[model samples]
Target chain A: MADGLDIDHIARLARLRLTPEERALYEGQLTQVLGHFRQLAEADLSKTSAPFRITVSDVSLRQDIPGETLGSEAVLRNAPASRDGQISVPRVVDDEA
Target chain B: MSESLHTLSATELSRRLATGSVTSRALVESLLARAKTHTVLGAFNSLDADDVLRQADAADRRRAEGKSLGPLDGIPVGIKDNIAVREQPLTCSSKMLAGFISPYDSTVAEKLKAAGAILYGRLNMDEFAMGSSTETSATGPARNPWDKDRTPGGSSGGSAASVASGLVPLALGSDTGGSIRQPASHCGLVGLKPTYGMVSRYGLVAFASSLDQIGPFARNVDDCELLFQALAAPDARDMTCFTAAERKPVHLPQNRKPRLGVPRALLEGVDAGVRAAFDAALEFYRAAGCELIDVALPTAGLAVPTYYVVATAEASSNLGRYDGVRYGHRAQGALNPVDMMERSRSEGFGAEVKRRILLGTFVLSAGYADAYYGKALLARTRIRDEYLKALQQVDALVTPTVPSTAFRLGEKAADPLKMYLEDLFTIPANLAGLPALSFPVGMANNLPVGIHLVGAPQAESVLFALARQFEGSHALANRIAP
Candidate 1:
C-alpha cells in the first residue's frame, strides 16, 4: 500500500537515512497518515492566507562608517564547525566554482 | 485557600480588588500555592515563584496608590510557553529549545505587563503546536484536572487544564486548526480563536506561521473576552495586526436582539449527548428571543485538508532555521557540521514534528508543489467565500466544538486518525480566518461541552454582546468541578 514515493525517497526528502526495518515501518505509517488526510480533501478550502515570510526589511548594503564591532568569538561560538575564526564545512553546489 | 484560589474568575477577582475585599498580593499568593499543589497535571512549563510574587506586590502597590491600569489590572494570566516572555526559557515543550531564553517579550506579553495584569508562569502545549492532544509535548501531556487519566486537549492543553482545575483564572493559548477550541471543548472551558491577525504574532514562537494565532482560555465567556481585550492590539511590531479592530468596550447591551446561526451540516458528527446538550442550549436561546437559523457553508468540509497542507508547508520552512546553529539544544560531539544538523534536529524535535516536516518537504518538492500546496490554496479560497456568504445570513454559526467531550488521554493518542477527527468541528473557523468562541453550554456525561459561536472578522463586540445575553438566560453552567 505504498505510493509512487518509496521509503528511500521519503527519507531523502526528510534528510534522513533509515535502516531497512525503519524504512518498512515508516512506509506503512506514511501510507496510513496519507489516508487520514483524505478527510481534509473533503473540506472546501477556498480562503488561503497570504504567503508567510519573516517581516524583515530588504536593504543588503551596510553603512561604510565606524560602527561598533560585535564579538567575533560570541558569533562563532554557535557555528557547528568553524576553523581559523571562520565558518567552515560542506560545500554547497557551486556550479561556477 | 487552595479551593478559594482555584475558583476566583477574572471578573470576580477584579471586583474583589476594586472593593478592597482582597489585595492582588493575596490572590497571587493563593494562585502560586495552588499551582504547586496541582503539579501532577503538567499545567506549567517554567514558573518563578519569586517573580510572580513581585509582580503581584507591584499590582497591590498600584491599587493602593489608586492607579488601576485597566479592567484586568491585578488579575493573573499565564503565558503559553510558545509566547515569549523575556528572561524565561520559552520552551514550547520541546527539547529543541530546552534552555533557550527569549531576549525580548512578545507583544501580547508586553501588553499584559503594561496593563498591570499579574504574570502567571508559562503553561505546557503541544510541541510546535502540531498535535491535537498535548501528548506530543517533550515535557509530557497535560492532564485533565477533572479526570487525571484523560488528556486536557492539546497544544493549549496545559492552559485549558490549569484553568479547569482552578490552578489559574485564565491563560493564553495559540490555535492553528483546533489547538485552542479543541482543548477548551475537551476540558469544558471558554476558548476563543480570533480571526487571523486579530492578535499580533510578533514574538510567538513560530508554528505554522500563517495559521498560528494566539488566543485566550478562561472558565467563562466574559473572562475570555477580558483576556482578549488585554492581549489584542494593532502592534507596530506585528504587520498582521488589524488597524480597524477595536478593544471592545465592556458592552452591557441595552437591546435584547441577538441572532445565532445553526449549521446542521456541521452538527452531523456531534455525539448524541453533546447534541442533546446543544439542542437544549438552542431551545434556551430561542426562548430568550435570540434568532437561531440553519445556515450553509458548503466548502467548510475541505478545511482540515487545506489546514494540514498549508500549516505543515509553512512549519517545514519556519523550523528550518533550527539547525543546531543558533538557538536550542545542539549535538555535543558531532563529527562534522552536516552531522550536527542531522543529529541535533532528529534528537531535538519529536516524532510528530519530524513526521510533519518530512511530509511538508515532500509536498513542497519539485514535482508535487503544484498539486499539494497549489490545490490547497484554491480550497482555502472556497472555504473563505462560503463563510462570507453564510455570514450574510446570520450573525454567528453555532455547533458542538468537538464530536464529544474529553475522552481518556491515551484512547485517541495511539490512533492518529482518531486524534485528528477531534478537530473536525473546529478547523473551519481557522481555515476561513474567522473569529469563533467556544463557551461551556452545559454538560454531557458530567463532562463540559462547548457550543461554538463564530462571527465575522472584527465582529467580536457582536459576539461578546450575544454571549452575555446567553449567560443571562441559560442554566449558568454553574457546576464548579475541582
Candidate 2:
C-alpha cells in the first residue's frame, strides 16, 4: 500500500501543497499510522452491518423568522482581501490556457 | 497582586462580589498582574489588558447598580483560544488563523458573558486542538506551573495552567479526545467534559465536530459545576445541542452504596506511580461506602486507532473552510484560485495540522473509505456499547486520567504516535460521548496524578457528587499548584 499510495494526489485532493520534504515525511508517517489502523480489520462484522445512532430526533425545529445575523462589515472583518462589502479572492474563471 | 483573592475559588469570589468586599476591576487587575508575572509558562497567547480592564469595569458597574447577572457576575475567567470571543484573535495556537479575529462569540463565551464573567484573555492550546501536549502550538507550549521542566497536558494546557497557577479561578476549555481532562489532571485542577450536546458548539473552531464538547476548568468542583451550568444550555444555532426536554437528570440512589466500575485490564500497563495513586483512590472510595465493581472493555485496545480515523476524517472536512478565499491567512502571488488555496493552506497550517489533514484525506479517499473509515465507525459503536453495558451496574467508571504524570518537555514531541497514545484513557469517554471529569487525587513522583470518572449520558450531577465527596475526604483536598 505504501509503494502504491500517491502522496501527491492525496495532497492535491486535500488542497494542500506539501514541500518535497513534507511529502516524504508524511508518506512514511501516514503509512505507520494506517498500519496501526489495520487492527480494526480483525473485527467480526457478522452482527454489525453499520453502526448508526440518531441522537437528535426530527421533532425539534427553530422558528423560520429572520433573526440577528452578522452584518456584511462584521463578516468581512477577518478577510485578508475585501472590497465593496464582499470578500475578494483570486479569479475564479480562467482564460483559455 | 492580591494573592488572597487569587487563591479564592470562583464561588467564593462570587460571594465577595455580592457583598461588595472586592471590586471586579480590582479582581481583573490582580489576575492580569498574576498572568503577566507568570508569562514564562506560556499559558496565554493574547491578552489586551485594556480590553480586559474595560470589561471588568463594566461588570463592576452592573454590580454597583444592583443588577448582577448571575453567580459568575464580576468574575474573571480566561478562555481557550479555539473557542471564539468577539474581537479576539481565535488562533487556536496555529499559524493558519494567526491574524483571524472572531466576528462573534461562541455559545460558551456568550453564556459566560451573560453571567457577567470578564472574558479575560485568549489561552494557548495545541495547534488546532490536535496534540496532547501544547508543544504543537505555533505560539509555544504552555509549561506546567507545578514544575517548569514538565508539560501541562493539553491541548487545553493553557486553560488548566491559568487556573492552577492562580492566574484565574476559572477558565473554559474544549475537549475533543481529552484536551480538558488530561490537562486538568497534569496541572492538579478540576476539568469537566460534559455530555455531548450538553453545551452548544456554535462559535467554536471545529477540530472534530461530533467529538468536540466545550467545558470548564477550575480549582474546585463547585466552581466547575457553576461554569458548567452557565454554558450547558440549548441554542438554536447548534442543532446538536440538547434541548430542555431531551436532557433528563440522572439521580444517584441515596440509600445504597454507589457502584464504581474499574476496568482492571485497562489499568494493567499504567506506570507504577500512577498505579499506586489509583490504588489509594480506590481505598478512599471503599472507605467512603462505594462498592468497587470490576468491568471489562474488550474493545478498548482499538480506541486510539479508531479515534484517529474518525477524528481526522471529520477534521479534514471541518477544516476545509479555511481556504484562502473566505477568511484567515492567505498566501500571496498564486497563479490561480486552486493554486492560491493550496499555497495558502500549506503556508498557514503547522506540521501536526497538515499530518492529520493528510491522514484524514487518505482514509476518506474513494477506494479506502470502507476499509478504514467504515470499520472505524463500527469500532466506535462497540466501544460505546461496551461503556453503556458496563455503566448499567455501576454509577461511573474510574481510571487514571493518563497512564503517568506529566512528562518532561519534548519527551514525546518527535514521535506523533507516542503523543497520540497520551489520550489512551481519555479517548474512550469521547468516543462514547459520555461526560467525564478529571480531578487531582494524589501526588506521584512529586507530580499530581489525576483520576478520571466517566458517567452515563447526562450523568454530570452524579459525577460531581462523587468528585465533591472525594475532594472532601482525600488528603489532597484543595491542593494548589506551587
Candidate 3:
C-alpha cells in the first residue's frame, strides 16, 4: 500500500497547489489515511463472496436510443463564454487545441 | 396540556389538517417562525421563505377545494443540503458549489411536493456527504440540539436535529454508510435507509452511488412509515431505482412471534453501555414475544473496508462532475481550464472529501484497480451474501446502530481512523445494501443509544410494524434519555 502511494506525483496530478508547508502537512495526513487502506489491502479477500441473494428492484435501464436534441439554445445559452454554437473553454491540453 | 403547536409529529399535524384544526398557511407560518428563531440547530443551509409560503398557501387553497388530502399535506419537511430543490443552493455543505442553485427538483423533493408537504428549508450536512461527522460540513458543524456542544450526527445531522429539536415534524435524509441512521441515533429520532434503490436518486448529489439511499427522519415510527410510503415509489428518472411491483408492501406478521437474529459475533467489540442497551432491547422484545436467534455473519468484519474502497471509488467518479464550470463556483476567474479544475476542486473540497477522492483515484488508477477496487467489490458480495444467508433463518437482524453514543465533538475528529471505525456497526447495512432503521431504544450516560433493525430486502414494513409495537409499549415509551 505504501508503494502504491506516490504523494508528490499524485498531488501534482490533482493540481492541489499544496504549499511547501501544506505539502509537508498533507504528507503526514495522507500517510495515516493510506495506512488504513493498506491494512484492508492485506486482508485475505479470496475466501469471501458477496451476497446477491436478497435484493429485488423493478427498475431497469432502457436500451440506448439516439435522436434526442438539446432543446433550442439552452445548451449553448449558458456557456461561461461561448463562440458560434460552441462552448469556448481555455485550451486545457493538446486535445482542446 | 396539549403538545406544543410546533412539536407535533407529522402524523398528528396531518390529522389536524384533515380536521381543519390548523390551516396550511398557519402551520407554515409557525414552522417558519420556529426555524428562524432557533437557528442554532444548524438544520438548514438555505431556505426560501417565499417559495415555502407560496406552496403552503397553494395547499390551503386546494384544501378549500376539497383536495390536498395527501399524507404529508402542509407538513413541513426539511431537505438535506445535498438534495436539489429548484432555485435553492445545493451546496452539499461544500464551498465548491457555494451558490449553485438547482435547475430542477430532485425526485424526492418533487414527490414530497406532490404530496403537499411544505418545504421547510435545506439542512446542513458533510461536504458531498463524504465524512461521518457533521463537522466536515463546510458551512459549519451542525450542533446537536440536545446539547449544541455535540454533533447532531451527520451528513443528515441537520435533518435529524431539525426534527429532534421540535422545529419540524418530518424531514428527508440520505444515508450512505450511516449518514441518516448514525445521526438519527445520536439525535434520538427514527431514521430509515431503504434498500439501495428503494428511493429514486435522481436529484441526490452523488456521494457513493452504490451505497447512497435517501430516506426519512421523523419523530415517531408511524411518521417515518408514512414518509417512506410517500417517497418509496419508483421513478423513471433513476434507472437504479427499484420498482413498486418488486417492492411488496411491508406488513406485520399476524399471530406470529417475531424471530430476531442477534449476531453476537459482530457484537463482541461494542461498548458496554451500548451492549447493555442492546441487551435490554432484546430482553424487551423477548418479554413481548420475539424469539431471539443467536446468529453469526463471518464476513461482517470486512464491511467497513469494502465500503471505503467501493464507496470512495464511486464518490471520486461521481464528484468528478464538479469541475468549476457549467455549475457554480468557478474560482472567481481562472487563468485556464486546467487551473480551473485544479484550483476549484482543491479549494472547493474539504479535507475529508479530498482524502476520499485521492484514495478513490488511487484505487481506480490502472495499477491498483484489480487489487483495491476489484477486491473490495468481491468482499462486498460476500458481506451482502452472508447477511442474506443469515436473514433466511430469521425475520430481521438487530444490533446497536453505532458502537457508542455521541462523544465530544472533537473526540474522533483528529484521528481519521477513529472516525471511520465509528461506522463499524452501521457500515455493514450499506455494504449489504439492505434496508435498516435506527430507533432510540434506550439511553446511555444521559445520551441516546439507537438500536438498529435490519430486514430482508424491501422488508421495511416489517421493520416498521415491529418498531411500532416497541414504541407502543409503555415501558419502552417511557425509556427516555435521563
Candidate 4:
C-alpha cells in the first residue's frame, strides 16, 4: 500500500505533478486498492511461470520495402508547438554542459 | 418511415438498402436528427453533420452504380474516440488530446470505410479508458438511455449509450478488462471482445497492450458479428493480430447445443436481479438442450487484483510517450522538458487517469516490481490456464456480465475499488485472450441485465451462435431506450 510520501515518488516517476488534494485523496484510495490487491498473494502460483508471453504461432511479417508514410507537415499538425515542420519542445540537455 | 429508421438493426437496414427502399443519405440524415434530440445521453464527443452526410452520399452513389461493398455498406457506425479515424478527432475523452486530429486511419477505421460504412461521431469514453463508469470523461459522463440519471458503463460507455439510444445502430469499442461488455450490458446491447490480437490494435490508443481489444456493439448478435467480421482481418500493422492463415473461420456451424460451464462460485456476490436473470438464462439454455456443468475457477477471485497490477504496469509504460513533446496537450511554460512533461500531464489528465498512472508507476517501480507486477504476471498465467482448462470441458463459460445493472452516476466514482470490481466476470476472458460476448438477458427495476459467455481462443462462432439463439428466444431482443 502506497502512502502519501510513496505517492509523491510515484507521481514523479510517472511525470505527473499532483496537487496536495489529489495526493491526499490518491494516498488513501491507493492504499485501500492495494489492500484489495493483497488477495493475489493467496493464489497458488507454484506451478505457474511469471512474465506470461502470448505466443502467436503464425506471425506474418510484411516485406522490408518502404511504403507511403505520413509527411512531416501532416505529422506536425497535432503538435502543440512546432517549428520548421518538426515538433518543438523545451530543451532537454543543459546547453552549458 | 425516417422516424423508425434509427431503430432498425444494421441487418434490417442493409436489406432495406439492398432493395432501394432507403438511401444511405436519408438514413444518415434521420439518425443525425435523432442524435440531436437525444444529446441528453451525452453519447458523442464530436459529430459533424455535413461530414456524415457526405459519407452517406458516397455510399448512396456506390449503390446507384451497383458497386455496393456488402451488408455494412451504407451503415452509419459510431467510433469510440480512442480509435483513430483519419482527419478526425481522437481524444479518448481526455483533455490531453483535446484538439489532436488523427493523422492516419486505424485498421478498424480503414476496414470500416472499405466495407462502405459511414464513420460517424467521436463517441465519449472514460478518460483514457481508465474508469468503469463514463463519469470520468472530460466530455462529462454518458448517461444511460434507460435511466438518464444513471451512468452508462464505461470506459466504452459512449459506445454502448450511442447504440442503446438508437443514435447509431452499431458502434466500435475497445475492451481492456470489461470496458466494452460492461457498458453493453448496462445499455442492453450486444458487445463482443474478440480474442486478443484477432482485431488489429494499430491506431488504437494503447491502454494495456496485452489486454486491450477493439470490438463492436450492436443491437443483436448478428449485427455484432457483421461488424466483427468486417474488423477481423490480418493486418501487418499489428504483429499480434492473427495471420491470414492463422485467422479462424467465423461462420457459425449448424445448430449444435453447446456444453456450457458455469462457475457458480463467481456468481455468489452478484446483485439479486443479475443473479436471477443469469440463472433464468442458464435454465433456458438447459431446457433447450445445452449441457450445463458446474465449473470451478479457484483463481478467479484474484482476477481483479491481478488485472489492476498488470494493466496499470503496461498502461504506465504505454502512456510514457505522452510527455508534452510531439503531440497531445502541451503546457504553457516550463524551464525544462521534464518540467514541461510533468506540468502538461498533471494539468491535462483527469483524476482517474492520474490515479491509474500513479498506481501503474508504483507497481512497476524498482522495489515493488517483484511483489506486485511480477506476482500479477504469475497469477495471470494461472487464471488464463484455468479458463483454458474449463473451456476444454465445456464449449463456453456463462456468467453475469456485471455484478449489477447500470449504476447511478457517482455511485461508485468515489470508491475506486468498488468500480474495479465491476469487471470481475469479464476480466478472465481478457487475461486468457479468449473471445467473450455480452447480450441482454432481462431487465430489473427498469434497467437491463446482461449474461456473459466466454469461449476458447478463436471460438467466436460458438459464442455468437449461443448468444444469437438465446437472443432469438428472449423477449428482451431489439429493445431500445425509452
**TM-score for all predictions?**
0.89, 0.97, 0.92, 0.98
lDDT tens per residue, model 3, B1-482 = 22356767788788888888887778777777877877876778887889888988888888888887586888888889888887677888888777666767889888888888887788988888877778898888887776778888887888888888777788898999999999989888889999877899988988887788999998789899899988888776787787656666555567778889999888878889988988988998999988899998887787777788888888878888877666544665777887887887787788888777777777777778877887787778888888888888888899999988887787777777778888888888888888999988877876788899898888898898878878887343322122
Ranking by lDDT: 4, 2, 3, 1
Q: Which ten residues in a row are the worst by lDDT in model 1 chain B? A: B244-253
Ranking by DockQ: 4, 2, 3, 1
Which residue pairs clash in candidate 3? A49-B381, A49-B382, A50-B381, A50-B382, A51-B381, A51-B385, A58-B243
- Model no. 2, DockQ: 0.66
Candidate 2, B1-482: lDDT as tens digits = 36677888898889988899898888887888788789999999999999989988998899888898988988988999998899888998988888888888888888888889989899999999999889999999999999998899899999988889998888999999999999999999989999998999889989998799999999888999999999988888888888888889786879899999999998877999999988999999999899999999999999998899899999999989989888877999887788889999999999999999988998899888887788888888889989999999999999999998999999998788888989999999899999999998988999999999999999999899999999987655455578
Model 3 docking tier (incorrect/acceptable/medium/high): acceptable
lDDT of 4 by residue, B1-482 (tens): 99999889899999999999999998999999998899999999999999999999999999999999999999999999999999999999999999999999999999999999999999999999999889999989999999999999999999999999889999999999999999999999999999997999999999999999999999998999999999999999888999878877544445656799999988878999888888899999999988899999998889999999999989989988888888888899789988899999988888988888888999988888877888899988889989999988888899999999988898899999999999999998999899999999999888999999999889999899899889879777667799
**lDDT per residue, candidate 3, A1-97, as tens digits?**
6566776676665555656765666667667766776656777877754523334343465446674444425444434456776666666666656
lDDT of 1 at B241: 67
Q: CA RMSD for every model?
A: 4.6, 1.5, 3.0, 1.5
The candidate scoring highest on lDDT is 4
Candidate of highest DockQ: 4
| lDDT to native, each model | 0.77, 0.89, 0.79, 0.91
